[model samples]
Target: MSKADVVAGIPGAIGGVPDGMASGVLAGVSPVHGLYASMAGRFFGGVGTSTQLMVVTTTSASALAVGSTLTDVDPDQRSGAIVLLTLIAGAMMIVAAVLRLGKYTRFVSHSVMTGFLLGISFNILFGQLPSLLGAPVRGSTAVAKALHVVLHPLDFDWRAAVVGLLAVALLLGLAHTRLRTVAALFALLVPMVVVLVLGWTNIGTVADTGDIPTGIPLPHLPELSSLSVPLVAGALAVTLIVLVQGAGVAESAPNPGGARSSVDRDFTAQGIGNIFAGLFRGMPVGGSVGQTAINQSSGARGRWGGMWSGIWILVILVALAGVVGRVPLPTLAAILMVAAARSIDPDRLVAIWSSGAISRTALVVTFVATLLLPVTAAVGVGVGLSLLLQLNQEAIDLKVVRLRVHGDQLVEAKAPTALSDNEIVILDVYGSLFYAGARTLQAKLPDPDGAHDPVVILRLRGRTSVSATFLHVLGDYARRLDALGGRLYLSGVDPRIRDVWTDDLLHAQGIHIEFFAATSTLGESTLAAYADAEVRVHREQRP
Candidate 1:
């Protein structure tokens, strides 16, 4: 590597190493696993991914979830399960790539992203509250622990806590001001210096970072005998949520020197990283948005930035392993808190809330899910709620109107008065015809107990395709219309959908087809039909 590459990569790798180790500790795993994953995963992903600055680490959300799920399992079982899930998730990603499932990742809307990140910010912030107060490292969830410490801070080491708090303040100040790239190191070191120099409060203090193992992690079979179905399900959910979040980070981030990223290439890189991580008994790896932003802001030039960092981390660990163990936990928490604070995007949250009720609802759902549910389950719940809200919105958008006869003309009570109660009644479709949306159309039809109007007109300018259930329902409606002394009229259909209708049995029922252009003649055809029907009505009245 070039001199610049060495300089940039060393710091990046060092920064990544601590975070990864801490994350593993936080997730109730051995620190070595975190190191192995960071070293190997970063190299693989960095080389393969399009975003040169992108880094992968254990996320607070995923860590919390993994901790919760694995905390109850026996040690052997937990290790086995983690390995199993890691491999499974890696396999799933490969399958997704093969099947071109990348499109699904795009479906996670802006609201979900904003809500998820905001929730994470809160999680990280709340998690650090006890540490800032000099409380013991305890509690499963952030809020619970914060409350516990607040209600009763036991044997609080005021001096050490002060050092940690100061460190956090410095880091935050540096980040908010001009000097953000070196914030992590400053955040870690300042507290160390304060504690070591003054010998303040005999709390454990680090002289330097600890030695790193020289060799790579040994491969061992992860025990799977104790793995339950629900555990596997939760792991799968975690993997999916991580993938979704990672893809967003990859797609949205600028590459080295402020360039765009190729999402596919990024995914390929992440896949490679995870595969290596699995081999090394490490958990799954994905892109870290905060880390990427930090690297970009730090003036990293190319992939060498990450590669150099990896090498530097290994060297530093070998040299400073003993010193690293002396590092205070409070200081680490403080640094994490500062990093979390920087990630808070209040404006994005406001935008999501302002978009509309549906988006607002999705945000609320996701935010609440993250707070209330276990980490792994939270993703599933949030995504489920978001999708459910979308479906409900589509349902509301889908509509059906009754077209009735008035002396030899059909008319519908839709906007723009497409038909003049003369030729046909237009049921204007404004949304998708998915499973949930199909109900709205079914409800708007005339009751079977009464004599229905003849020649029902279905203005299909907006409908793109029909599901099996939707097709079946429409077929039923068409059959009913035919039996009720009426015929179905289809207009304003795009050729793509028209082709399906032509081949489908639903179109076999007696119906009239009109090439009403949605941009033009759809309204004209309805108006002309209504006008002709009005003339017929007048003639019948005269007789």
Candidate 2:
């Protein structure tokens, strides 16, 4: 590795310390789990990812997702549940990669995703309030706990709040200076030193929650007993979150060498990383946006930058395992709070809000769902929103344009509102013909009533597939036209579409109509269908 790669890895590794531990707190587990994830993800993920500089690590979103996944498990079973959840999510991700399902992540609605992410950021900020203030509160949800903390300011422990707020201030201040690379480290260190000097035994430490293990993480078998339907569903949600975030990281941090990264390869890389993290008794890990930015900005020269990051984390773990436990909980909370604040993108939110009611509704609903519901349910809501947006677009986008054969060049115009007697109309369709789109097209088609002996030819060029709904719409339209002494003809139909259409009951109904398969030359099928229509019209008009 070059000196540049080695140097770049240092900053990322240093930054990973506080972020990893804080992420562990976020996941409602031992801070060391996040530490383990940091090391394991970088070690496994960095080796195989197509994006060489991409650092897979403990991200806040993935941590919160882990917490939500194990919310219902018994306290004693949580450790095993964490491992099982991570393993299931990893397995699912590898399956997705094997099936070449990476490209479809792009279809996720931008507005919905933005809303979900923003909501998660806010949730993180709110959830950390109790720890940040060192206040005891009772509430079922993050929002409620935050509200209780807010309403009962007198209950706050001023000492813990000062420590947390001091860390926050230092983080914000150093962010503008050249020392921003190590600001988080100082944020944790300064507060711990102050608390130690003051002898504030009341302030909770990382050790208060659990024992801090020394040395490198080792592999452990997952508790197969913890596996359940709920765990499987939650794992699916975790998989969705990681894959989507991985796609986003790729977009933000492109390869410096102008090499295009394979999405599926990166997906598989994350899967392997998570699998290793789980085996090593770590929290869930993924392509972290913050750490990837850190690696890139540090001038990472190659894949080794990321690989060395894992090594650096291991070095720090061995050296400072004792000091790490002495770190204050409030300081960790402060680090997470600052991260949450920086994560919000107001400009994007405003842009989505200004787009239209459809966009605004998606953004608002997703944001609300994320706040009020569990993380897995929020993810489901976001997915449902995406499907709704897709169906809405398909229905709105479908259009029927009239195409007239003028000598050699076909002329385009608005389709007729109603077909006329002894007339031939050629219509070309645009947009999807599936589900709601087919229904929309059926509604927009020209009425065949009072149009005797009329012939309408629909050009289906370039369409290799059709939904069953499309066939039903066609059957109904054909029956209408035939009942009015008219006929509907399909031109340029693909052989595959013909096969399906021929097998359905709609084919029997289509007997009154005719369909012509596509040919090598463009418009050949339509032209032939049109000529036949003219002959049929003339024959019908003959006394």
Measured by lDDT, the strongest candidate is: 2
Candidate 2 segments exceeding 4 Å error: 503-512, 519-521
Worst 10 residues of 2 by lDDT: 503-512
CA lDDT scores, all candidates in order: 0.64, 0.90
lDDT by residue (1-543, candidate 2, tens digit) is 799988999999999999999998898888888888899899898899998889999998888888888888987788788888888888998999999999899878999999989889989988999999999967878899899999999999999999999999999999999999999999999999999999999999988878888877779999799999988998899899999999998888888778998889999999999999999988788999999999989999878898789889999999999999999999999999999999998888888989999999999999899888999999999999899899999999999999998986678999998988888999999999999999999998988888898899999999999988888898888888888788889999999988877645555565556989999999999999999998989989999
Compute each candidate's TM-score over C-alphas.
0.80, 0.96
Quote model 1's TM-score.
Answer: 0.80
lDDT, candidate 1, 301-401, per-residue tens: 77766656666666666666655665666776776676677677778777777888888877887777776666666777766766777678778887665
lDDT, model 1, position 314: 64
